[model samples]
Each structure stands twice: as structure tokens, then as C-alpha cells.
Target: MRGIDVEVAPGEVFGFLGPNGAGKSSTMRMIACVSPRSEGTLQVLGMDPGVDGPRIRARIGVVPQQDNLDAELTVRQNLEIYGRYFGLSRAHVRAKAVELLEFAQLTERADDAVEPLSGGMKRRLTIARALVNDPELLLLDEPTTGLDPQARHLLWERLYRLKREGVTQIITTHYMDEAEQLCDRLVVMDGGVIVAEGSPAGLIERYSTREVLELRFTPESAPTAADLAHLAERVEQLPDRLLLYAADGEHVHREVARAGHRPLTALVRRSSLEDVFLRLTGRSLAE
Candidate 1:
């Protein structure tokens, strides 16, 4: 991955999106002050990370891609122990632990051992633990990677609540929907550089047509990309299907039918961040 430029305003949710090893994690680590940058200027909260690492880190909350909860401790104890590292008074830590547990919807599990919690629960606890110090900025890396749909949505809701309460956030995720849901602005990273930067809608508007028509055919019945060249602004050929990018999906659908190409299946949908990434990178965002 390459070093990239980004500026996130206060109280905003900024998303960093890319495939595995696209440098998203590298960027996040730099921002989190866990890994030193090899070159270029890096600033968090108007302070230089190199000189003020501890001070900058004290004001930031981090939820890593993987949960690192202490399995030997109960939920509340984990938070209590983490707070001690930050030098919070014992009384303050106790109060904060209870408050955070309630905020994370884990009050009932406060006494339960972390080893017995589900993945989502443990993730929530990790997030809660990060908040013990009342950070001004939160960093979440691939926050929803392995969760079920319901769990993902629940986490999204929790994050949205934080955003509403004026907590600035920087997130790195591979899920297009996660970017669309949580990001006020985002930069699409590929090969260690930013390929595109804008709000979800802005990127979609700039990189893709207004709509997309997905056509699938039998393995033996596929049409050449050239066969649909004039049907839309752009035509992307894939092994199993063809994506026609056009202003009007239905219009392109009809054009494909009139061309004597019978597709096995067809669907029309609005453009999305996934379309923008694919258009710019020439590769699926996740793959």
C-alpha cells in the first residue's frame, strides 16, 4: 500500500475502504499511533503523532479488527482493568464501567466471563472498553467483518448513535453497505493509494451511470463485451455475467433484448459504491 492524503473534519464519520492488504490497515495503524509512518506529515487533533504519541493516543479510542478482550476477566472487570491503564481513579473507573456497559447494552452481562460471550457481544465490549476514557475520536478497523447481518445492523445502529452524539469516527471496512451506511465521506484505496474520494452518492454519480443492468447467461450463451458496447456508457464483462452501466437500466435492458442476446436472467438496480469502486479499480472491491 502507498501513503495517501486525507482530511477529516471534526464530528464527521470518515471511511477508509479497500481490499485486504490495500493499506487500509496500515493507514489506520498510523492514525492510531500504533505504527510509525515511514514518511510524510501525519497529524491527529492538530498534534504531531511522532512527538505527542502518548498524549494523542490518550484522546483516541480504538477498536481493532479483532477483539482482544481479556478472557480471564468478567465484562466489567475487563473495562475496569483497561481504565486503570489510563490512570482513571478507581471510583471514576467503576462509574465509567457501569455506564459503558449500559451504553453497550451489556449491563446484564457485566458479571459474565468474556470467554462465554458471542463474537458480537465481545466486539461490543471491546468498543465499550475503548470508551472508558471518553475519547474525542474513535477508530474502528473492519468493525463488522465476520458478523451476521443482524449483528452488523445492530453495530451500525450503535455507531450511528455515537455519531449523533458528536463523536468523530474513522472506519476502515470492505463492506460497501457499511461504508454507505456510516460514512459521511470516504476515500477508496487500492494498491496503497486513494483512487477516489467523495460521499457515497458523489462517488456513484461521478464514476458510474445512474443505473446498472445485470445480465447473466448460460455458460455457453454469453455475449461478447463488444456485442453490448453501444447499449450503455460502459459494459463490464465478467466470467458469469455482464454489467451494463447506463442512465436508464430498463432502456438498456430493452436494447439488449432487441440485439437478439437472450440473457438467462436480468435485474436492474440503482448505482452504488460497489459500482464506483469496480469502475475505478477494474476489480471487485472485496475480491
Candidate 2:
């Protein structure tokens, strides 16, 4: 992927979406002031990152891709140690830890050691720890990568609440549904650059038809691209299926059936960001 260029408005949840090794983490690090950009202009909160790294960092909350919480300390102690690094007063740190524990739904486990926490619990604690200073902007990199479905939903609810409270968030994830549910706008980065950028709906509208018709057949009997020609505005052949992009999926399905070539299976559905990414990059969003 190429280096991306986009702006994230305050009080909005902006998602950075791409596959592994797509430079998503690289971009996040630069914005977090942990890694400096080699070229191009970069700014955060209207301040030049190169000139005011410390000041920019002070106002941002970062939940890195990896869990870096101190395993030797209890959940509450971890928050206290992080708060101390920000030069917060002892009284303030203690109060903030309690509030964060509650916010993370970890008040019951406040005194529990980090080593004993489940993956989901650890992730939530890490998020709470990041908020100890009440940052103006929050950055999350693949926040739910290793989480189960229930845990993912819980985290999403917490993030939604934060958004309602007017927190500006920058999230990076390979999960299509997560981006659709959480991002107000996003940029699709591939290689080292941005291939597409818009709201999830806008990207789908611009890159793909309103609906898609998927036709599956046995590998040996699959219809060739030429066979499905004229059935849709565009036809894409996949390993085991043919995608027909059209204005009306049901109508396209009828057309396909009328042609006397019966697919083993077929379905019509509304277009999604996954379709948009596949159309633009010629690969799945998670690939």
C-alpha cells in the first residue's frame, strides 16, 4: 500500500482499514508521535508533530496493537503507573484509576493481578489505562484482533458510548463489520498508499453497484467470465464463484436464470465495504 493522505475531523470515529503489512500500524505510530514520518506534512490538534511531539502525545490516548500492561502490577496499579508517567498528581491518579476501572467494567478486578486477566479483560483494562489522563483524542490499533464475538460487541458498545460523549477516535482494523459499525469515514490503504477514501457507504456506492449477485458452481462447471458477459454492468470471476455487479440483484439473478445456465447456488445482497475494497484492490479486505 502507498502512504495515505486524509483528514480526521474532531468528534468523529475515523477508521484506517487494510490487510496485514499494509502500513496501517506505521501510519498510526507516526500520528502517535512514536515514529516520525520520513516525508510529507503531518499535524495533530493543529500542532506540528515534529516540533511538539511531547505536547501532542500528552493530549492523545493510545491503545497499541500489543498489550504492554505491566504484568507485575494489579489492574489498578497499572493505571496508576501509567498516570504517573504523565506527571499526574498522586491524588488525581488514584481517583482516575477508580473511575477508569469502573469505566472498563473492571472495578471488581481492580485489585486482581494483570497476569490472571482474560484476553478480553486485558484489552479493556488497556483501554481504560489509556484514558487515565482523559485525553482529547484516542487511538486504537487493531483493538479487537484476538477477542471473541461477545467481547468484540462489548468493546464496540463502550466505544460507541465514548463517541456519544464527543471523543475523537482513530481506529485501525482489518475487520469489515467493525469499520462499518464504528467509522464515520475511512481510508483504504494498500501497499504503502491510500487506494480509496470515503464513508463506508460512499465507497460502496462509488466503487460497486448498489447490489451484488453471487453465483456459485462446482469448480469444474463454473461459468467463465465470457459466459456471464452482458448479465451485469461488470462481472468478476472468483475461485469458486462469479460476482455480478448490478443495480438490482434480483433482476440480475432473473437474467442469469433466463440464460439457461443454472448455478448450484445464488444469492442477492446489498453491496458492502468489502465489495468496494475487493473491486479497488483485486483482493479481500482481510487478505
Candidate 3:
């Protein structure tokens, strides 16, 4: 990782946005205290990770990119066993498991084996297990990667509750909409370095126009960036479409018509985090 520096305030939902090999996972590992940094200072929850790794880890909850729940164990047993590893008494672990099961909306499946549960159920259980110690800080790595929309919203609601209760969270995600919805403040990283940092709206306003006019045409008739440059503030040519960035998308669309440009389909939408991401990270796919 490069010389990355960031500060996440208490009770805030901070996000890390990047493509593959952007050092997000490496940074997360260091913050979780499972991997040591080679240089520079690192602090998590007011303690230096190098000196207080265990203490820091004890106070933070981590929901990894993938669920690692023991498939052989029942849903309730997964939570109870994890809490036991924290040295909690059996009675306390039992009570905590019950509360967490309800929080995860998995109480009905508490007695069922992990292997039989749906992907969403397993994800919820993993999150509940992470919270067994009632951590002050939570680190989530792609908390809702593969779940259906319904399950994604459910997880978002649960996270919102945690935020309301003043539990600080740091999340790393590839989904632009998810980051925009959950993050109060975020930083965009590329090639192991932070390139941009701000709230979702702030970044969009800074990096993009107020609206976007998307125009699609047949492959052979597609307009180049130079062809539509005067119709909008800027134009981005994609393999399938042309994006006209402007403060007024409808105005640009009308201008395009007046300029004798006909597209197969035209869509005018508000600028979003995805627009800002592609602008900052480039439209090319990251390996």
C-alpha cells in the first residue's frame, strides 16, 4: 500500500471505494490488526495496532468479504461458539445468541444447520456473530455482495440501526449505489493511493455535472466525443453509448436534436456516484 492517510470519526459510516488490487483489503487487514504495517503509524479506536493488536481487535467487529460460519454447527451454535471464543460465560453467550438471532431475523432458523440456510441467512448470521461482543467499531468488507435486492435492503436497515445506536463503521465495497447510500464520507482509492475523498453528493458535484444525457446509436452511426463536445460541457464515448455531461440534461438533449443528431435511445438522469467513480478511475476496466 502507498502512504494512505484517513480519519473516520466516531459513529460515522466511512467507505473505501476502489477496483481490484487497489490495496483496500490490505488496508482493512492492517486496521483489523491481523496484518502488521511495514511503515508509518496506524491507529484503530484510539490504540496503535502494532502495540495493541489484540485489545483493538477485541473492541472491533469484522464482517469479512465471505461468510466463514461453521456449516456443521446450527445457526445459534455458530453465534454462541464465536462468543465463547471471546471468553464469555456460557449463560451470557446463550443470551447474546438469542438477541443476535432476533437482530439478524434468523430466530426461526436458530436451531437449523448453517448449510441448509439461504445465502442471505448465512450472511445475517455472520454479521450477528461479529457483533457478539457488542463492538464499538465495525468493519464490513462487501457486506452485501451477492444477496438479492430484498436481502440487501434488510442488511442496510440493520446497519442503519447500528449507526443510530452510535456504532462507528468502516465499509469497503465495489457497488457505487451501496456506497452512496451507506457512507457519510468516503475516499476513492486507485493504485494503492487515495485519489478523492468526500461525501457521495460532494464528490459527484465536484467531479461531474448535475445531470447526464445518455445517447445510444447503432455501432456504425455512433458519434465521437468531438461530434458532441459543443452540445454539453463534456462528452464521454463508451462502446455502447455516448454520455453528455451537462448541468441541464434536457437542454442538452434538445440541443442534440437541433444539431441533427439522432440516437436510438436517449436517457436523462441525475449524476450519481458511478459517474464520479468512472470519471476519477477511468472507464477502462481494472484487472
Ranking by TM-score: 3, 1, 2
Tell me how many clashing residue pairs each candidate has. 2, 8, 0
Ranking by lDDT: 3, 1, 2
Clashing pairs in 2: 1-190, 1-191, 1-192, 1-193, 2-192, 2-193, 3-192, 3-193
Q: Give the TM-score of candidate 3.
A: 0.98
Among residues 3 or more apart in sequence or in different chains, the pairs in candidate 3 whose N, CA or C atoms overlap within 3 Å are: none
Candidate 2 local accuracy as lDDT? Answer: 0.90
Relative to the true structure, candidate 2 reaches a TM of 0.95
Give the Cα lDDT of each candidate. Answer: 0.91, 0.90, 0.93
The sequence of per-residue lDDT tens digits that candidate 3 reaches over residues 1-287 is: 78789999999999999987788888999999999899998889899998999899889999999899998899999999999888889999999999999999999999999998999999999999999999999999989999999999999999999999999999999899999989999999999999999999999999999999999998877778999898899898888899999999999999998988889999999999999988888878888
lDDT of 2 at 111: 95
RMSD of each: 1.6, 1.8, 1.0
The per-residue C-alpha lDDT of model 2 at residue 27 equals: 95
Higher-lDDT candidate of 1 and 2: 1
What are the clashing pairs of model 1? 1-192, 2-192
Q: List model 2 lDDT by residue over 146-242, tens digit each.
A: 9999989999999999999889999999898999999999998877779889999999889989999999987777779888878898998888889
Q: Which stretches of candidate 3 lie over 4 Å from their true place?
A: none
lDDT for model 1: 0.91
